[model samples]
Target: MATSKFLFGLLLLLILVEMNIIEQPWMPGVEAIDCSGKCNYRCSKSGRPKMCIRACNTCCKRCQCVPSGTSGNKDECTCYANMKTHNGRPKCP
Candidate 1:
């Protein structure tokens, strides 16, 4: 009975580990995307550089893409384009 319980516990632990592995968004061996560089380019023309970089980074991470050019190309990334501030203003640069 004790041996059976031990085996069952081991099986449960393995199943949980496998589930965690499957649920992860990032996969091993895939190159990490450069969110900082893209966000920098996206926010370059803004008067508020810090604020723009901060917002752009958040949007880039969530959208996994940044619109091309320094400004007014939000249409390139639907997720980035759709994010809004508390007062309904656009979020990304």
Candidate 2:
């Protein structure tokens, strides 16, 4: 009986930890930004991909772009490109 109770408690703890990890926001993955058309032009002309990445990192916490293949993970996070226009042009490559 005691062993069963300990196991149950351990399981509960593990579950709580898992929940926390799932709930926490995740940072953007490498190769996350897609420099297609306008995005590439803006980044190249302005030289500000790092700034865009930073902005996206901050905004992604609240907004959801796309879900990840991994369970309970987000594949795409919200970024500036999605939010604002890029110099009246389309995305770049």
Best by lDDT: 1
TM-score of each: 0.66, 0.26
**Residue-wise lDDT of candidate 2 within 1-93, one digit each (tens)?**
999999999888778756664342344342233333323333443456766445434433334332232222322433423544357541211
By summed lDDT, which 10 consecutive residues of candidate 2 come out lowest? 66-75
lDDT score of residue 34 within candidate 2: 39
In the order shown, the candidates' Cα RMSDs to the true structure are 6.1, 12.1
Cα lDDT, all candidates: 0.83, 0.42
**Per-residue lDDT tens digits of candidate 1, residues 13-48?**
778757765343455544446999988887777899
Which regions of candidate 2 fall more than 4 Å away from where they truly are? 1-46, 66-93
Output the number of the TM-score-best candidate.
1
